[model samples]
Target: MSDRPATSRVLVIVPAWNEEESIGDTVTEIRACVPWADLLVVDDGSSDGTRGAAENAGATVCQLPFNLGVGGAMRTGYRYALRHGYDVAVQIDADGQHDPRSLLSLLEPLGESDIVIGARFASKDDPYKVRGPRRWAMVLLATVLSRMAGTRLTDVTSGYRVCNRRAITVFAAHYPAEYLGDTVESLVIANRAGCTVTQVPVTMRPRAGGRASHSPVRAAIYLFRAFVALSLALVRKWPAQFEDPVAP
Candidate 1:
């Protein structure tokens, strides 16, 4: 377990969209793994009973009236963390692909950097293979983002990440607000805002239940959108000021 400050307030933010099949179990597992952390599930207008399931599993549900996509739902979580004065916030996927047991590993790096990504590709013991076009796309994104952030990034699209107070504040205000926006664009936003970002090796499990949101066609669309978003992020000027820097 991380030897973080005892006063640090940590929150586990789970963004769900039609993940009723797995959200409950995901919440339960997180509670078991990190019982001290508060849990919040942002239901992005899921058509099923995702909200109720998450609540029943002992998570505070933040229901959106309409579909806002993952990026918007994540922004909502960041806003909540900032408003509640949380010292750290971790983003966990509702699909169960992100292992709750790795939550502590993700938090371990927050002492040295503002953001720590739980990178799947960083793990040597458990090789999670991404075959076909999706694999190629991931490689391209990782290469581009690594150059932009001035650091090696193996899993650019990984959702398992921990962020400190400064990151929460910046994300709450300027998070990307579009489809497939959060991953690449948000990294650029954090780097441009002068927040240090790093990654730790983590093994991921296959989704516990329900269909994957990304089909082959969707993967292609995401790649195109990601490219556009990254390009735009490159041209955007840095904001005049950011949130107060937090001590490592």
Candidate 2:
């Protein structure tokens, strides 16, 4: 594993939709924590003033034409990072569950891997927990993905992730835009395209603002959705394997 410097040109991309409540503070915290990195908030056609809030908090906001979900927003971010000549790209939720302070540690493994996942449950000490079917779905996904990538990945659903230039190139062109596509399917795409993956344990916190999107009560439905996501990811045909066309 090559050791990457803490000073690599970094772009922190935050995909947001109607996150005006938390966008400002999230931007502020990222700037305060990773001051050396550039911040971009891809506002996914929010009906609120998310763009203005992010700009006021000192982040460059990229407004989408319509709501394309987190997957589409991040695809834009990948393209932006590739075009602007950034060495690293990191994606964190705009809701603030992903702590900005963990970002540096998340990027540490990039020298040796194409992707570094800021996993929420890699360590036994991590207190973050999902109960019932949600937990089962996540565990099932992790077990299968770990085997596929030849590495133990505990939290495949977590959105906090860091990617190097090579992974960015692959994602810029072929990142999925479907539901659950950003985290689960994206990893499969990266692995299939010959990218290496690793993880660092991190604890998740309560959202700084906005509402939580998860509800464990819908057990059966959630489990079925998870299965469908994984099945679709496995059966989909990738036209041509990504081979880092851009010089790194």
Clash count, one per candidate:
0, 0
Name the TM-score of candidate 1.
0.91
* True-structure lDDT of candidate 2: 0.89
lDDT assessment of candidate 1:
0.85
Against the hidden reference, what TM-scores do the models get?
0.91, 0.94
Best by lDDT: 2
RMSD of each: 3.1, 2.9
